[model samples]
Target chain A: MHSFFGKQLPVAVAFFSGVLMIITFFSGDQTVADFSQEQLVWVTIVGGFSLLLGVASITRVSLSDVRKRRKGWPYKAVLLIFLVASSLGAIIEGTERGTLYDWLFQNMNAPMMSTMFSLLAFYIASAAYRAFRARTVEATILLITATIVMLGRVPLGELIYGKLPEITDWIMNYPNLSVQRGIIIGAALGAASMSLRIILGIERTYLGRQ
Target chain B: MNHDIVLFLEMTLAGFLTLCIFSFLYKDNPFYRLAEHIFAGLSAGYYVGLIWHSVIMQQLWVPITQNGQYSLILPGLLGVLMFTRLVDRLSFLSRVSIAFVVGNTAGISIIQQLHGFVLPQLGDTMSRFGQEFWGPLIILIGVVSTLIYFYFSKEHKGALGITAKVGTVFIMVSFGAHFGYTVMGRVSLLIGRVQFLFVDWVHSFNKIIN
Candidate 1:
């Protein structure tokens, strides 16, 4: 009974849902299309509920830490307080655009996210300096290409060389585009095969087992 | 009470949070940790609110109640079933919900990947061949050679080895170009932060002083 409900039922459900979606894409019938679209909406709603699982997990972890008086438990407490306060504020306000929710997002969340991302610039610069050594032919080509693209992308390149932008454009349009296209095709094919595997029930990894 | 005063306060708070996040570059400290925790909690709360309002209320609840689409109740039930994973005996029930998501995504992606990515990219690559001489030839060589490099079924030797080597060069150049572009993007983000600090915050301060 466990295997019947756990393994077989789930696989059947997945196969049915997947086939319906594919049918929706190909079928010209408005009724079928609408039904499929509605089903997709249900999938999205189900996906959204998964977020609650995450929140629950976090809450459980934080509460356990607080109870244990763990190191950095104070920070965990602060996190939980903010989490509860912000959620309550949003729920009470009934809209994210409401005063407290909007303010917290704009003042706290946005700035931190932007600043954290911006810090990557410094890290990338340091990494490039360390990693982009001209050791071999391949490395030298990479270094040269990186230098050209970097210089051509900014005003400094034009200040040094008049034709840098033109060369950069040529490289981007031809060789870069070709390689990008190759990669796209390869990745698309790979993804399609994986999707097929899932649909055919050959891939049961999603069921939490090999 | 004034709008300008409100704006100034918001900008000041944002700038302070931004600086706190940036302080991580010096070393991990109390200020950075506070900002990080606040950001995480607030963002998670915001997402929860958003999912409830936008997805659940708009898509599921409204359709079921207002439109009398009672069929949606099934998927909603499936979504609720996802929580059964917390229970030892009923944990298998969660597989049904996951199956729906996996199947739906796979079905949708298969056709979209083929139509949107694979075919168009191949067509574009082939179409470019007759348009120009050297440019197209170079692109063709790059694409073919790069594809060969990615083909791991046959071991590289003799002619295949040289082709794979050429493919490696193209791949390296492509990677370098991508890295350079990413650096430029990150630098631009950093520039935006600097501008916000120096221009917007400073100007606001001057306005208050005046």
Candidate 2:
């Protein structure tokens, strides 16, 4: 009974949701379509609420760490304060233009996030130098294709070889597009299978317990 | 002179922070640790604000009032149910909320899969021997070989193996191309940061001479 209600119930919901959504795409009924759209919004709202659960968990864990004076307790305290302050600011001031919350978002958050993203360049370069090697048939092909694409993408390559643009277009349109498409199809099938397993209670990792 | 001093201070601090991160290449050091901890705190605070403003405010508060209180009631209930994770005795109730969330997500994913993945690929495959035969032929080979390479149940010892080997080449070339492009992108990002530091934060040589 527990398995059926607790675990399988999610699975059943997953299965039915999938089927209904698929049907709604082709369904003629306006009411059915509207209901499906609203249901999706509700699901999104529920997901938003899950964030609160996360915030709550973070608060509990970080406060405990601070109380214990763990190695990074001060940092945790800073994080908690930031989280609470930002959340409260947004709620009270609202997120409209010219608000303090919006200003912080534009100046501090965007630049910092962009900085972190840009840091990836250094990491990727280091990784490539250490890892990229043409040890096998596949690796060799990859190396060659990568070279062509790189050359074709930039104006320098075209200047070096006037025909580079035509060749790059050919590679991207044919082989690249086809292989990417096949992978997409295969992955979709795999996802469907996994969703089915979860709905049926054959998979329960999401439940976060045995 | 006053504005110059303020700019100098901000520029100095930003430069120091950037270098602290770069120091990671040499080895993990105290400077790196300090910078990392500071970034972690700032980013957490920023993200919490983002989630509150972009998601919670837009999806929940506006909808509750602008749309109707009735519209938000069920979602609120479901959101509250997620907090069952906190209560040891009533944790089972959380499953109801999870089921709804999972079910709705699975449903949308299934529909999107067909639209976004299946149809696009089918169009490509069906359009084979298209306007350009050479382009279509290469794509055909790429699709076939990549599929064979991914066929895990079979052994690649015969003619089938050779084809799979060929497929691996194509995939590798594609990856190499992607890697090179990524490197170039990172270099550009670094350049952008340097430009901002130099141009925005400091005067040109002409202004200094004046």
Candidate 3:
């Protein structure tokens, strides 16, 4: 009974919902389209609650660490405290305009994310220096192309050479565009095939063990 | 209680956090760790509140309470079932929720992948042939050869080997261009932070001083 509901039922549900969505896309029926749209909303609602799973997992781990007095228990405690505080603030104040939630997000969250992401700049430069060595024919081409593109993208490139931008544009438009299109076509085909497989129940990986 | 004072405080806090995060470039330290953890916790909490307010309150709560739509309870139940994964015996119940997501995404993606990606790319590639003489010709060749290179069933030998080599060159050039573009993006982000520090914050402080 457990297996029937847990495993088989879900598979059936997926097949039906997926087929319905496909029908909604291709069929001209207004009622079907409306129902499918409603189903999409349901999916979003389910996905929204799914976010709590992550919070629950993180909270559990943090609590366990605090209880065991792990190496970074203090940090874990800080994380839990902030998590609780921020969640409470947002929930209590409401996430509407001119709220504490918005203020925290704008001031703290956005800056931290952008700063963390920006740190990749230093790392990427270091990586390029190490990896873009002109050791072979291919490596040499890659190194030159990368240098040209990087230079063209920045204001410093124009200062160094006026034609650098034009050359960069040509490379990006012709060769880069061609290769990208090819990659995109191939990926789309692959994705379509994979989607088909999943819909048809050929892909059972999502079900996880039986 | 001047608005400028609050704005200044917010800017200063953001700058401080940004600098703390950037300190990771030197070495791992308590300040960096604290900032990183706080960012993680706060973002997680923010997402929780955002999703609740946006998806649950709007889609589930509002409709059920205000509009009196009871059908939403089905998806709501399924969403609740996902939490059962935390339990040892009841974990299988989560599969139902996963199936719904997987199926719906797979179904919708079929038409979307075809319309959004595959068809447009195919049309674009084909249309390029009519636009210019050599440029489109070269693109068509690159696209075909690249696809052939990825076709692993047949062993690359003779003409296929040469074509595959050309395909490899295109792939390498594409990768190099992508890496350069990514580096540029990251660098721009870094530049934004620098600009904020040197320009915006400095001007604000200057105004306060005056």
Candidate 4:
């Protein structure tokens, strides 16, 4: 019974939904197509719940850390406080302008998040310093290309060299476009094949096994 | 009068939070840790409220009540079933939700991947082979060579070896261009933060003092 409910049932569900979606796409009937579109919206609604699952996981982990008095228990405690407070504030206020949720989101969340990403610039420079080795032919090409493109992109590069922008455009439009197309083609093929596998139950990793 | 005071406080808090994040550049200390925790907690909480309003109220509740679309109830129930994972005995029920979402994505993606990415990319690459012959020829060479590089079924020897090596150069150049663009984007974000700090924060501070 457990095996049927836990694993087999889910696999069957996947097969049913997968087949239904494909049929709807190819079906000339308007009703089936409409149902498929509605089902897609259902999928989206279901997906949102998955994010709530993430919140549950975080809360559980943070609660455990605080309960156990872990190394950063004080921070965990602070996290819990903010989590509860922000949630209540937002739920009550509805995220509208002049609401506590909106103010906190704009003032606190936006600033902290943007600053965090901006800090990545400094680290990326350090990373580039370590990674930009030109020992091989490919490495030399990469280093030169990166340097040109980077220099060509900025206003400072235009001040330094008149042709940088034009050269940058050529590289981006030609070789970059070609490689990007190849990558897109490859990825699309891979995705289609993987989807087929999952539909056929050949891939069961999502079911908690290899 | 009170609104002005709140605005001042908001700007001051945002500036202080921005500094807290930047403090990580020097070293990971208490300030950075505090900011990180606060950000994570609030973001998670914000998601809960966002979903409660956007998905539950808007998608499920309003649709059912106002539009009399009772079909949404099934997906809503499926979403609620996702919470069953919290219980040991009924955890298997959550897989039903996962299966539906995954299956839906797989089916849609199979068609999307083929129609949106694969066919369009192939068409674009193939169609560009007129008028500007050399440019398109270079693209073709880059694409074919790059694809050959990824084809690991056959051992690289002689002609294949040379083509694969050429592929590596194209790949490297493309990668370098991508990295440069990414860095530029991060730098732009960095500039935004710096402008906020220098202009907005400083002006606000100056106003407060005056």
User: Best candidate per DockQ, number?
Assistant: 4
lDDT of 1 at B128: 69
By DockQ rank, best first, the candidates go 4, 3, 1, 2
Tens digits of per-residue lDDT, candidate 1, A1-210, equal: 889879998888889889998898789999999888887888988998877777767878888999999988888888888787777777778654646877788777887798999999999999988877999998988888888999998899999998888888987887788788788888898999999899889988987742
Write the residue-wise lDDT of candidate 3 on A1-210 in tens digits.
987987678878888989999898779999998999989988988887788888888888888999999999999988888887788888788987688778878888899999999999999889876777889888877878888998988889999999999989988887788788888888888888998888888887977766
Docking class of 1: medium
Q: Count residue pairs with overlapping backbones in model 2.
A: 4
Residue A37 displacement (Å), model 4:
1.8
Residue A165, candidate 3: C-alpha displacement in angstroms:
1.8
Clashing pairs in 4: none
User: Which portions of model 3 miss their true places by more than 4 Å?
Assistant: none
Task: Grade the docking of candidate 2.
Answer: acceptable
Candidate 4 structure quality by residue, lDDT tens digits, A29-138: 99998878888899989998988998998899999999999899999888888888788887787888887777778999899999999998998999988877888888
Give candidates' CA RMSD values in order: 1.7, 3.5, 1.5, 1.7
Strongest candidate by lDDT: 4
Report how far off residue A208 is in candidate 1 (Å): 1.9
Q: Chain A only: give the TM-score of model 3.
A: 0.94
Chain B TM for prediction 2: 0.77
Return the clash pairs for model 3, or none: none
Interface RMSD of each: 1.4, 2.9, 1.2, 1.1
